[model samples]
Target: MANEDRPRSKLLTRLHLGTDEPLEVVPFLDDTGHGVFATRAPSRPNRIGLSIVRLAGIDGARLSFEGNDMVDGTPVLDIKPYVPAFDVRHTERIGWFAERLGQLRGKLSDGRMR
Candidate 1:
């Protein structure tokens, strides 16, 4: 929240970006190295929330989307288009997650950020 709080800026359009979790700092306090950066945890040191929901439609000021993983009233902070050429990477090695890849399919957020 800013002192000159206003509506979502027009600069952000048809983009996917970060928001503010606003509820807690560091969703998983006991998490090891790199903290929230190591995981897709909602709450982080900067309170920046991120989602890659599809931009379904835009009616004036209203934006309709699908596949949202966040809750209601999440404050958007920034936005940018999902450019596959710049974003996608074919990598087999991911730090810390290399060994935990098998568990991802069954894993779920347990409200640690709330």
Candidate 2:
């Protein structure tokens, strides 16, 4: 397979989980039910994280992107092209996030997880 270096703006990256105790469940924002898998809580059992970032540019061996949610120096496990057809899902049931959608904008992470 030819390694197509075509400029793809979207990329899916697997990252090493940060330093946090593995939690089975946490109160969502201290108000909702946030079972570990139900919420994007950092402390997961597997200690692996997934993020979607915008591919900004390729400079020799360096790559930069926007929308990096991981901490600085976070180890990246893998990377793959983000194909919307396979990644995007149109589903009405988003579990707990469905009701909290309005709180997303301007909402910053509190140190509760720490």
Please report the candidate that would top lDDT against the real structure. 2
lDDT of 1 by residue, 8-102 (tens): 22122222234444433343323344444666565445545556566656799777655555665555555656655776789877766666667
lDDT against the true structure, per candidate, is 0.51, 0.63
Candidate 2's clash total is 0
- TM-score, predicted candidate 1 vs. hidden true structure: 0.56
Best by TM-score: 2
Worst 10 residues of 2 by lDDT: 1-10
True-structure Cα RMSD, model 1: 10.4
Compared with the true structure, the alpha-carbon lDDT of candidate 1 equals 0.51
Task: Enumerate residue pairs that collide in model 2.
Answer: none
Q: Which tens-of-lDDT digit does each residue in 1-114 have in candidate 2?
A: 222543334433344544455455564454744667777766666667777776666799777766666666666666777887888889879876776778778766765533
lDDT value for candidate 2? 0.63
TM-score of each: 0.56, 0.71
